[model samples]
Target: MDPVARQTLLAAMDAGWADPRRLYAEASTARRLLDQAREVLAQGLGVRPSEVAFAPDGPTAVRWAMEGLLHAARRRGARTVASAVEHSAVLAPGRHRATTAGDPSLFVEVPVQPSGALDLPAWNAALQVPGTVAAALQQANGEVGTMQPLEDAWDACRRAGVPLVVDAQACLGRTGAPTSYDVLAGDAQSWAGPGGLGILVVPEGTRWALPGPPDPDGALSGPTRHTPWVPLALAAAEAWQQTGATLDADAREATALVDALRAAAAALPDTEVVGDPVDRLPHIVTFSALYADGEAIVREFDRRGFAVASGSACTASTLEPSHVLAAMGALTHGNVRVTLPLLRVAGGRSEDVARFAEAIPAVVAAVRAEVGAPRW
Candidate 1:
């Protein structure tokens, strides 16, 4: 973590640690702080704090979002569509289960451009499918870091009378993109907030389907009198306010780095960077080196004191090609995903990044030399 981020966390932790549920002055402080957090977050996301419901974490937030969308749109029927580049939660095959007569409920696969934008033609066609209740897509790709055209997609779904659910897990607050989604989900950890807190931004007046006693008409799940919910909301909001315009800066610098690396690797005979070159998210880049092990290069970089990420970080177990690249008909098995930390020193603007960029050719050369990529 960056030093400034760390300091912010420590301060937020100290101030937000008080349980807002307690019936005392400390509790009152916590409640006020938490309320302030939600308001701040709403300001950053261009929504209302009342619309933002905090969850325990990101995956849970996703589950709640999917199921809530299902319930909210249940009156329509059991059809859910998600972009092919959607996260695992939305891409779950279970959502497309077999029904009576052996025909499965439709789980339409809408294609997104390599740059992570919605495929308008496919989206238009998919929404026209009868019984289509809701659609899900990440606000941006986590692995590839491409921002989706949620505004346009949301508009299309609206025109088609379909509700849109977005997992803003990686892009929320970071990108500052406009969202009019029925359900927008994300986590605090994605933006340096404490773990165990997730966000489901549900605007007021939107109907949501939740599984439970139905005590309250709004909010995602759990009781309103919960502890830490208020604090986490407040902290997340404050963090967002302090980190405004981050998306543009991160996107710009990361895009430049991607271009730098892509050019450097292009000099090699059998190397290719994946994802859309432009109109993509600015913070992430992935590439595949033919015949060269992804882990080997990542490890080599780590050894040199530069911390970067690889596609499907669990490469040692399954060297399978990245699903995103595979979907694009591009290389996958030997792919690396570099996510630049918001702090510039983490290879964003300093020598750390320049050195990493400079080291690419040598790493590719060394790996290719060992595995014999190609002579030309």
Candidate 2:
């Protein structure tokens, strides 16, 4: 979190600790702060405040968004369509729904191009697959940073009368909020806000319903499953304001740094830099080195005072091969992913990225050598 956002969070913790559901004076104050926070987020997202709802976190919001649509359209169809590279949050529930229904066809996994961009023709055909109730596509790929063709995808969904649930979790703070989704989901942490806060926006007339049992207060009809913590909401709102104030400048710096990193990785022997170089996220870069171990590469970077990610972007803890890379036909092993922090955050300067770039070649060589992989 940025220093100012952290300070705001600390201040809000003291000022908005009361439960807003109560009718007491302190509760009223807390309620006011929560409402103000909602409005701020709505304005930042370019949506109506009434359309915004909070979730426990980003993945939950995504699950709710997709599940809600599927639940509402149960009679119409059980089928759901999503790109193969969608975050595990979207794909896991999708596969579960299909598995539980005893029909694999209930989930349609569309393929992507080598650049990590969706195959538009395949996406269009999939949407037309008779029973698709909802379709999900991230605004950008989190692991490889490839931006999807949202407008084209949304148009196809519209033609097929399927609701589009966009997991904007990766692009919300970095690339700006998306305007083409029927339901939008994002994480607060993406924008330098504290974690545990997820943003869900269901525009009016979106035809969505809560997937589970009704809220005791009949509040499940709203966007959120539960009331968000007032302090976290306020802190998120502050972070949004701070990020929005500096979004363009921060993106330019990140873009340059990522470009440098990408160039360095691409120059290394048998290493493939993934994602669309020109149409991708400004701050994320991923590269795969043949015959090297992803975990070993991560350890080397960590020892060099630079933290990095490896394996699947979502399933890294399990050391699973990246479905994103697999779908893109890229190398799945020895992958390193970097997501630069927001400029206002610590370790986000140009010098930090430069140092990392300078170490990439040696790190890859050292890892490959240890594994007895021949140099090109």
Residues 236-294, candidate 1: write the lDDT tens digits: 55556545646567656667876887677667667777766775666677777787777
Model 1 residue-pair collision total: 5
What is the lDDT of every predicted structure here?
A: 0.69, 0.89
Evaluated against the true structure, the overall lDDT of model 2 is 0.89
Off by over 4 Å in 2: 212-221, 312-319
Q: What is the C-alpha RMSD of each candidate to the true structure, in Å?
A: 3.3, 1.9
Error of 2 at 283 (Å): 0.4
TM for candidate 2 is 0.96
Residue pairs of candidate 2 with colliding backbone atoms: none
Least well predicted 10-residue stretch by lDDT in candidate 1: 217-226
lDDT of 1: 0.69
What residue pairs clash in candidate 1, if any at all?
A: 37-234, 41-237, 146-281, 321-332, 321-333
Kindly list the per-residue Cα lDDT of model 2 for residues 55-157, writing each as its tens digit: 9999999988998898889899889999999989989988998899899999999999999999999999999888889999999999999999999999999
Best by lDDT: 2
